[model samples]
Target: MTTRWALLSVWDKTGLVEFARGLVELGWKLLSTGGTARVLEEAGLPVTHVQEVTGFPEILDGRVKTLHPRIHAGILARRTPEHLKQLEELGIGTIDLVAVNLYPFRETVARPGVTTEEAIDTIDIGGPAMVRAAAKNHEYVTVIVNPSRYSQVLAQLRERGEVDLFTRRMLAAEAFAHTAAYDAAIALYWQREIYGREHLPSFFFLVGEKIQDLRYGENPHQRAAFYRLPGMGSGTLAGSLKLQGKELSYNNLMDLDAAWNLVREFHDPAVAIIKHTNPCGVALGETPAIAYCKALQADPVSAFGGIVGCNRPVDKEMAQEMVKIFLEAVIAPFFTPEALEVLKAKPQVRLVAAGEGQGEGLSWQVRPVSGGFLVQEPDVYDFAEQELKVVTQRKPTEEELKDLLFAWKVVKHVKSNAIVVAKDGVTLGVGAGQMNRVGAARIALEQAKEKARGAILASDAFFPFADTVEEAAKAGITAIIQPGGSIRDEESIACANKYGLAMVFTGVRHFRH
Candidate 1:
């Protein structure tokens, strides 16, 4: 019987000793390098160092350990007679399997204040070369890069005495993907280092690990899965910890993200009720319970089955109030033990803990178009007091200014042509994704009804005409806030003055389409 040779080299030594032992038990010679060999030897398994096969000592601080022609030829040579004869003439043995994983380049760079030299040292050259060579010769050599596949590969070898061609091909594909993502991480890190985070690179590589496979996409027929970006911090929805309830769906994730982002805008105890990626109602109060009550009161009908987000921890008081309604999900920084017990009354509701603090690291907002993607900076800009210009003759009162700022924050998260009517730090009505600005205003005004009187209105963009202003004035709106860039902005200002209403221009447009 011919002696089967398997080469193993990996930075992550997970399952390495046991895997090498399995190969040794299966009558296979183990060839490894440096740390991997040390681990196998300590496990009392017979293993040959790569340097012994290459007949050359490892040099360059172990960077050139597995780059020799002996290692490459052994793994890449075919099983054909001609290839075997060439290997025989070169005194080289054919390696039937190669298991290699690259260095921790991503993790190293993700560390706070990581130096360039530290990051550069972590770039694995010989490892990727070995993995790719073995993957390319998958017809002859089986390649494994992921440690999770060790058990399955060992099982296959134990049962059949060899890995099948189909399994080898799949392993090769995975090995290539592993190397690709590794390279992408290195490329992105260097790009960001050389040209600042604001500079857009010619080639953008997005690498993600599959977090879960959803039951369905937005609809039942469509397929979908959730992927977490590499090195993502715990502040995002992807990093949220699920405390209870059924698995999150695609739509649930979407709505949860919207609710979380909206609620994060306020410093006070805030709550946002979201439906279909739009805020049905939002408010800030002394406590999360009060905020939830006010936000729910804004639109009780729309709040039904909606997702809820809170900036502060969910306490027993808040949980008690939340359980009174039918909420699909509630996400907060944390949940008290008493609160969890109270929330247990509604076991179906999803409880997620999105960790506190600002979203760590920079991220681009990405949207898919027909052929490619639209990448832009997130709308994290908040208007300063200096940016506010009272265009109308009447300046907003102190109370109206506070509500206008609150309404402005809420409108920024709404879809384009958005309108929000808010009073006393609570959104009374929201009109989003309308075709016309006046149409959106009318919808919001209609929703507010009597509550619209003395409430402040916020528009996501400049009014194209005076129609929205006239509509707001008729609704007894006391103040209006919008970006003032339209050619007909003066007309809207004149109408505000005529109605004795205060209108402020933020000098910024937040279109959330």
Candidate 2:
């Protein structure tokens, strides 16, 4: 066949110039539009303009570029006798590749004071159109929508003078994902502007590409991978820099996510240790090392192989102590050179830095089901213990109050509907991810074993029924803390009264579901 053609358009200008030059060297004709075309052509790349290719100049302020049948016919037509006849009749070249990234609606919305009009202006119509067309023609065209994929396409092109079928398939998947996410961001934005509501019609769209296959899942037999979601076109966990050894595991990611969330709850120097996707330990201290020590001492047993997150830069002293423990990952805002020297010795531990280096990711949660998924708002509670209310009679003593507050801090990190039992500034037991309220309490009690006798119990939510309160009483739980809003409040109160257990309702639920 004659030299194949490639179309390129992108809002993100990264690596576009060099990418086009490589395409020209590979003997593919590069066709781009407006700024993208200008960017490539000005850089001395042999980029053919869209107007030159389609015989149609951009109209409606460049909104009408690449919407013509000439563009679609080239990408969509398979290499069949009839298709060849039509292509020859119209002198239309086959588009074997399409590299297009949509406009920056997600980024525009993410700005500190971006207006609705500005966000709307950032939504690109023709860009998504071309991406969808190219993706739909996976059998004919290779589509690359991300700058990261530019290198991949170049490598494949250099190796075989063509992208392989598998790479083409994967690229097509990414192209469609790019368009889908673009539409979702636009829909989400319009929904908010028009209806003043965030939730719109459900289409169950999740667009991400696996950046890595993790070392392992939560268990040995299970498998895991990390996918990149274009969260506001901002930095993500997968995008973070790995400062030290080993690939992150499934449990490591879960714990890192947990720790990241908890530490972000406090702006000051804070430390958080996450175990089994729950914060078994958290503390704010004058120094980063002191905070980490306090957090580790909170629940030493549970902290083994746990993930740690710190808002402040981890110092040398903290890094030394961290090396002693078997940690899965250590994520902090930053690490001093001295701290890095200490962490470099432990290759098995994954050291991540916050911001770009640190993978404290954007706030979002997506849980999978058999046929579909359940997407809800993530819990981002930032409350101080002072805001908590004492809703019941018989106030807890100073010691019990300290444990109660600590347990409350820990309970927020547990899966919901959740409950945690603690004493002496350490978690004695944690019950999580149970269906019923009472079942969670029972699990916490059972986990606590004999330790629940004098420990303070903290529930993520109010008891729907009083059975959980009565059950905690049987376990000899002393002070109880919960967010009160249950329908059967009187019954739960009576249950707490029966056992003389001090119960306080903070009027704030810490549900993690």
Candidate 3:
């Protein structure tokens, strides 16, 4: 009678035959149940069936195969005298190693239209029982669940004739984690499927795969890495393809995210130039080349060494204009051969080819804090012209209304206390991350100076007082758009009338922090 016996029962048979053959070659007997035994026997490997050991045939549509006392008693038995005597008296063998994997419950329920019966049938009852039995008695019994760990397990068995204590403990921990994640997925799906709960649950289960290790974090001295959700959509930066230049750093990814998100807000040809996670210049045009040039002209100095995001492909003309100014990176859907030829001259610059922008999908925005993280839904609100309330007596003309909408789109992407002054579909000045709304208005007006005369201004939030409107009047701003939710909304509206400014209240605020 062989003292070292291995039990193999699995739903996923990725590398079962080779693993069984290796154990047999190492002089260890194999014990398996239904599907796994069929696979091993077909491969001409000798395997003892669970029915032969337990004297009970599998019943109930093969659900009662491995849940018998003979199987679990062998795995859970200790090496003590009393345990050994009980197993010996019952004619049960000691199962040293157990290899099992659960059914694909997550994949089954994740399909488009999975029904209750199909999902319920896919859940395994005996697999988790066997895995937990082996994991709990890890001091005496070794466990194997993941196929990736097969080669290492066989190497240890061949080298030492048995798994070492350290390997057994490590595998035990991994087995517990594997079962935990599987159960979490089941709980989440059932809660959504049965109770129709969309809010956050009392408990959260997060699983992530490491994308890459960056050079550093926000600073050079700090270490950082990037992780992606298991099934995230392709619209995100993690799914983007890096076609050229070096690996992205932490700061580069942040700036690229800002630029890419801002550029996607436009339907027409548009370009967004971002620096330090703020839009320095943004514009729209009939062609991508013209858009890039106009965006650069908006704030040429700030555009230097910034990231550029284009909604359309980059052609030779656009590439020509891009090379004249030093930029940190460029991202677009595609690039012509001629454009690539000219752009490749600057090897240090990063070039990314992302696919077309997709509409907003169900996703969560996560931010880490000291202890844990904060999760919220993404901001995908659209400000339509019909939703605007003309608060001032002097309504905006058609042209002013067009520029106001453009400025509104751009200002939403900027940081909190943000302001943007625009005319003719191009930004004249942008003030971002100010302490007060009036301070932001002053900085934007100072930059727009002469350009402020006919430009329309857009603010992310309402003006607490009438001071912002008063300053805009002094700066020659002709029109203004804001959310207008303050207690003194009448005061701001009265000041717009005083300046003869065309003011509209969106009744919605976009505060990005």
Which window of ten consecutive residues has the lowest lDDT sum in model 3?
A: 355-364
What lDDT tens digits, residue by residue, belong to model 1 across residues 206-257? 8888899999999999999998888876788888899999899999999999
Q: What are the runs in model 1 whose C-alpha is more than 4 Å off?
A: none
Residue 38 in model 1: shift from native, Å? Answer: 1.5
Could you say which candidate leads in lDDT? 1
Q: Judged by lDDT against the true structure, how good is candidate 1? A: 0.93
For each candidate, give its TM-score against the true structure: 0.98, 0.80, 0.86
lDDT (tens digit, per residue) of candidate 3 on 1-513: 555899999888989999999999998899999889999999999999998998999999988988888999999999899999999999888999999999988778867689999988888889999999999999999899998888999999889888999999999998888788788778877777765645676766676557899989999899999876544545667667787887888988899888888988889999999999999899999999999999998999999999999988889999999989789999887788899999988878898877664624335577889999888768778967899999999999999999999999999999989999999999999999999999998888888889999889999999999999999998989999999899999999999999899999898898999
In candidate 1, position 478 carries an lDDT of 93
lDDT agreement with native, every candidate: 0.93, 0.80, 0.89
TM-score rank, highest first?
A: 1, 3, 2
CA lDDT of 175 in candidate 2?
77
Clash count, candidate 2: 3
